[model samples]
Target chain A: MMAGSALRRLMAEYKQLTVNPPEGIIAGPINEDNFFEWEAFITGPEGTCFEGGIFPAKLVFPPDYPLSPPKMQFLCEMFHPNIYADGRVCISILHAPGDDPMGYETSAERWSPVQSVEKILLSVVSMLAEPNDESGANVDAAKMWREDREQFNKIAEEIVRKTLDLPPP
Target chain B: MADDASSSSGITGNTVENSINQDELIMKQQREIEKEISETIPLVGEIEELQTLEKEYNEDPIYLLKVKDLSSKYKSIRRTRPDGNCFFRAFSYAYLERLLTDKQEYDKFYEIAKNSKDILVALGFSQFTVEDFYETFMEVIQRVGEHAGSTPDLIETVRMELHDKFNKQGYSDYIVVYLRLITSGQLQTDQEFYQNFIEGPRTVTEFCRQEVEPMYKESDHIHIIALSNALKVCVRVKYMDRGEGSQVIAHDFPEGSTPLVHLLYRPGHYDILYA
Candidate 1:
């Protein structure tokens, strides 16, 4: 019963997106019958190093959604300190709601169902601008970030080049 | 000995006859119950069919004649032109009302709304009302486009644009027309966009029917009216207590409140002294 309501809301959200779409984001259900799983394509932010990158991601919402946040993971390879080897995004907004065990985030910083894909993308853009080095999803990248700033930038630049299919910057 | 054997044989034959008689009686009773059950189906179907036909026929010329008679009784009542602003303010509630009661009435009204020229002029002023809604909606889109990067900025921009759009007197007239569809239950929120815009007014009516009907059950009308009236008071209090931000401007909400409306209202939100 709870799942039914969440499904309905998810469908409504899907419908809203299809009608009055936000820029730089294209998302819909994987299948007409399945609103629980959505496939989203996001264009890399304009005027950023990651420009021209067309990243595909998946959003899987739990049955008790709106009360719980969806899990969003990049299907495409993304090499960054904040992105894990498994392609899971590490951001404050996507974290489980409430106090963080490692004392990193406040309750307000965590994910809420009210957080739409638009908000999440915006947060990711902000994250790209400023990475949280303290809690690194990729330890090697974090080490590079802390130890050798130039080398870290080089590696990020290389990844961005590969993403855009251009020569290394 | 012979006489005793004969009498026993005779008694066995009588016992078999008695058993057959009992079986026939049980079979007869079952048939009567079966017959009654069989007869009820056609009778019930006929009754339901008649009721349906009766309703459809009521929309005929005879029914219109009865309506004419009723109207003649109240003929002295002048068809006064409603204040444009008042009409705009009342649209949502009235639209919601019509949406719940009869879907067809809203459909008929929407059919008349297909011509943008007719909708614009026939509604309140000259043939320009539909054009006005289009412009206002476009303005909202343009405002949203301006704040492309941030979520907070997007919300703020949209709200500001809506505030401007609604403040204009032309929009007040449009709101009434929009509400007329809602109250008539012709428009549903879930209808496809092509149907809503391209098809006649019925689509808008359907949108109201689908979107807002579920929010308030028929039994809850009195409570909803009370709540709406109380909301006015809340807006007033917010204006007086908070100063600058609490004006009940169209489409603008209290700052930083979530985009979604709080469907569940507490008792205090509606506590008002009604005469």
Candidate 2:
């Protein structure tokens, strides 16, 4: 029953998105029949290693939505401190709702039903500019970032090149 | 005449008193039952009504809003129900299906769904693929509507077949293989071509490159970790946080960051990155 209602809500949001698009974010239907599954393109935030690079990703929504957040992963290989090798992202807003059980995060930082795609994309942009390395998903990447800033920049540049379909340096 | 009058009067009084007592007992019992019904009926009705609304307007947005209003109205009622919290999850699937089926007309549906962390994790499960969508649809109309189980194996089998093809292509990326299978239909020119294209490796690749490649490119290390973290956060936030141990440690780093160092902060302890 709620699923039907949530679906309708999603549809209404989709209608509005088509008419007015946000900057640095472009996304649409993955297929004609499925709205829950979409392909998205996010340009690397300006003045970042990912700048001018078009990154592709996927967003898959569950049947029982709004009560849950969508899972998004980049199809492109990226090197970042917060992302795991498996193509998963780690943003605070994407965290599940409520207090962190592990005593690692406060309740205020977790995900809520009110969080939107615009917010998520904006968070991603922020994530690129400044990653939260306190609890690292890609521990190695995080370590390298904290210990060796120069090497980290080189690796990131390689990723940017690859993302742009350029050969490795 | 005096003896007959006394006996008849006493007998009449006793019978009337007994009849009155019985009537009072019956009325009391009826009132209790009525009270119980009044309290429980609304909650059950809300659940039923929500389910009915889903069946009636599975794809209609306007009607769905009415259902949402009803949900809000009876928030307390649902809180009392055992599986009331599952409503968001249940609705997300229906909402997702609607969005997928009528993408052009219902783009906003995806946006709404994207808000829920739990829903996102469920959708990421391999079971919610496009092939499963078809299978689910057919099963619903098969006249034997057994709507109480997890996804059937038929769809999984197809995914397995597609996995074999991926191995042959020398592509080790699991996400790539998964996307190719789900979005296979988008590659076809018509409905007739969908079946053949989805099942065949050559066509699936062609379709994947055109449709899946661009999005795949955006999935950088940052996105991957964020996604994985989101999944964990959803589990922790939705399920574990309610448990005894509910703490999460999150660390963030800049892009192009590498994890290759050992930190020594204690007298004899150092944190080293494990390969």
| Residue-level lDDT tens digits of model 2 in A1-169 | 4356346546655654566667888776688588788777888888876687787888777665544567788889877877878778777666552212221243224443334565576777778777766545676777788899889888888887888889988
lDDT of 2 at A79: 78
The number of residue pairs in model 1 that clash at the backbone is: 26
- Residues B1-275, candidate 2: write the lDDT tens digits: 88866765757745554455466567667655754653452211221233443465678665555445444433211111112212222222222222233334233322332333234234332222222223322322221122222254643443343323222211222222223223332233233444352433445334333333222222222222332232221111111111222221223222233311111111111111111
Considering the two chains of model 1, state its CAPRI-style docking category: incorrect
Q: What lDDT score goes with residue A1 in model 1?
A: 40
Chain B TM-scores of the candidates: 0.23, 0.16
DockQ of each candidate, alpha-carbon based: 0.01, 0.01
- For candidate 2, what is the DockQ? 0.01
* lDDT value, residue A18 of candidate 2: 68
Query: How good is chain A of candidate 1, measured by TM-score?
Result: 0.82
Error of 1 at B125 (Å): 33
Question: What DockQ does predicted model 1 obtain?
Answer: 0.01
Query: What is the model-wide C-alpha lDDT for candidate 2?
Result: 0.44
Worst 10 residues of 2 chain A by lDDT: A99-108
lDDT score, residue B137, model 2? 27
